[model samples]
Target chain A: MIIDVHVHTRLGPDPHGFAYLLDQAAELDVTLCVNSLSPKDGTGMPESPTEDEIRRCNDWTAELAAAHPERIIPMWYLNPAHEDFACRELEERLAAHAGLQGVKLWVAVRCNDPRLDPIMRLCAEHKLPVLQHTWFKVTGNLPGESTPMDLRELALRHPDVSFFWGHCGGDYEYGAKCARGLPNVYMDLGGGEAMNGYVDLLVEHETADHIVFGSDAPGRSLISQLAKVYGADLSDEEREKILHRNAQALFDQQKPANGAAS
Target chain B: MIDANAYLGNWPFRKLRYTTHIALLDKMDALGIEKAVVSSLENVFYKDQLAGNRRLHSEVHPHADRLLPAFTINPTFPGWEEDLDVCVQEFGMRVIRLHPNYHQYGLDSAAGSAVLDAARAHNFVVILATGLEDTRHHHPLVKVPDVPAEQVAAAVSAYADVQFLVAAANFSGVSAVWTEAAHTANVHFEISRVQGPVGDIEKLCGTVGADRVLLGTNLPLHVPEAATLAIEHAKITAAERRMIVQENATRLFGLG
Candidate 1:
């Protein structure tokens, strides 16, 4: 089964929001792990999401996932800065909607920041996978931006939790190398230029089992993103692991050990 | 559609194992790309661009039927004008690509203007590679920024008689120079690194007439099939698709 681990409903109210994503997902023939996004302007992401904004985004995600249980899988987006509030909301939301399969951490706090410890702890308890936003900026690693190394440190800190590094650390080559032997760390092929040789490098240097397919949809096209892996020179076995097997295995592990969510 | 932006030779930063002209053509053939305008990656990093262009001419010679040479010329280098003449006169290369970001030359400098003039004089199609790789993914030790779009637009406006193709201008980069690209008649864009929603090709076609866009994959650096799929999946009329994928470039380069 082809699965896209990264997708969003919409940041704002558009009559054609979830409908648009569903239609595209059908055309692309992949199950989507849909997340919520705060309202955004043309420039980029919305200013740090407010408490109400976070709640609304999570609501939208749950509604869509519940509507298409077979196709749409919900992943919660949290702002770790609002530590107590975020933790409260995640508990309330997950209890309310049992369909949430993962957690998405944006640039609200560095992956290594202690602020994320609570969220990571919660994920570890729930056995939920974490997809953290990462970008390898030219200006050097900024405060909020999560590099692959930062993710490596975090993944090492929480060995019980599974962390999917987003955008393959933006640059990918270094990201793949950093993720090599970290059993808990997985790489998602998302965002940025689909640099040539990057995917091959990942498969050769980093095990294909460690890489997952993610299309940062609505902002980018699925075909273009899929082409990054589909067009790469990889074996059928390696391609299968990246396209679905690995992601399925990750989700299959989310059994909420000890009835953690309840 | 003929790809207006392609490359031969190795890039020092990455192991693009498929760097030979033959490998490029075989890959292009697999993707159904009949022809492509090619250049050498050596030109991107080498200080002696003359030698790089010469190497490109020789490498592309065997497969001249499928690969058309786009020689790189750094205007700031001494004897660059003579090198340009050799690129056109000796090699008969019709397209001249400039890497101001890699070569460290201002697009608006006097030497830059002279290079544009020489291309115009020889009727060469000019491809200003706005960027080769995304800045966020550049090799740490040698990070190269994209050639400023503003400078490219200014140059395009300054030389109306010369046709300028902007290669590797992603969605943001295109938006940054939208006003200038819209007003300037001679400026065209190559859709190699343009990232947007599903109907992005159509969106760009509407913004800058379809005639102003060309098919480019930046192959050996990108997936050629991916570039083609983007065009094939875009919501556009057959005529508009024809213009973007082939006719515009064919006419611009006098491919006939």
Candidate 2:
């Protein structure tokens, strides 16, 4: 089965959003892992959310997972800068909810930041996979924006936790290299700011099992994102691993420890 | 469905093993792209624009059944008129693409105007290569900004008699040129990189007329089925989908 390891729900509290997303994914014959980051706050300039807003986002995802036990999975979208709240929320939610699949980190803090240490430790205890947003080829060497190297640094520090490099390093050629020797760092192929041969290059350098398929949908085309995997010249077995098996293995390995549903 | 935009040749930044015209054809067949209007990377990279045009025409001639040549014409280049004539008169090329950003000329410049005038006289469809890749993720050594929307609007306004297609434009690029795209009847947009939301195609069509949007995949640099499948699965009526996939491009390119 094709499991999309990355997707975002419609921003804000629209009760109908998750249902709509599930329906759309059904058309492609794939299940979804919806990151509960509101489009309004998840992207653009990062805004600090109140504790209530954070709870609301996580709670919304938890509820969606409850509704679709078999079709949809939830990833905890946490602002690592709010370490205490993030840690508390993960503990609270994962304790009660077994379907919460992984943790998603965006530009809240660089993947290499020491501030992320506590959150990383917490995820390690729970054995939750970490998906960190990464990009390159943009203006302004912004302080908090994580690069492939930054992600590599963090993955090196914590060999136990698997890191999904979002956007495949977002136009950075070195993304595949970051995963070359690191068994824990896998790449999630997504992003429009990509070049041809990007996926092919990744497969060549890192092998296919270390990569996962993500659409970054609503903001991107699911068909297009899948093409990044399907269009690549990989064996059926390799493609299957990237499309579903790798993710299934990662999430499943953690399930017995964290008690998430298979 | 016609792919309004596609490409052949090497991208300096990334390796695309399928850079040959024949390789593009294999890809086209696999993706179910009936016809593709293509430009050459040589046109954007080569200093001498005419040489690039000749190379593109020569390369695409054998595969004329599925591939249609869209020559690159930089107005600022010397002997541009002759090159335009060669593309039009000699090669019978109907489509001409301009790289305003790469050519280092504004759309409103004398050079730009002269090319537009020649294109008008010769009855050529003009495709403004507004963007090659997203500006945010461009290589650090070579930063190519997208052609500003205001410039596109100005050109569209100036050349009201000419049919203009904005190529490789994203949503922001569309917004920048939305007024011209909506107001100017001759102005059209190609969706090679316009992605957002679930029903973004319907949203764009709702904002602009469905008639103005054309199918583009930015192929070789992008996966062709990405756009083709996206269009096929869009939440629009059959008629609307048909227009975007084939009818609109067929009519615009005079591929009757």
Q: Each prediction's Cα lDDT score?
A: 0.80, 0.78
Tell me the deviation in Å of residue B211 in model 1. Answer: 2.5
Off by over 4 Å in 1: A10-20, A40-48, A66-70, A255-262
Backbone clashes per model, in order?
Answer: 0, 2
- Give each model a TM-score: 0.93, 0.93
* Candidate 1 residue lDDT tens string, B1-256: 6998999888887788568887887888788788899998888888788898888888888778778899998888888888877877789878999888888888788878888888888888899999887787777788888888788878887778888888998866776676764357878888889855545676688888788888899988887666788888776889988998889988888776
How far out, in Å, is residue A95 in model 1? 1.2
Worst 10 residues of 1 chain B by lDDT: B175-184
| Model 2 Cα lDDT, one tens digit per residue, A1-262 | 7888777776433334445567878776787887766533444224455566667777777777788778778888888778788888888878878664788887767888887888889888877888888876466545667888889899988888888888888764767777688888778986663356767888888888789988777566576677677667888899898988998888877767756477
Summed over model 1, clashes come to 0
Cand. 2 TM to true fold: 0.93
In candidate 2, the residue pairs with backbone N, CA or C atoms under 3 Å apart (3 or more residues apart, or in different chains) clash, namely A11-A39, A218-B197
Tens digits of lDDT, candidate 1, A145-238: 7888888889989999998789888888778878878898778887766667778888887788889998787667676788888788889999
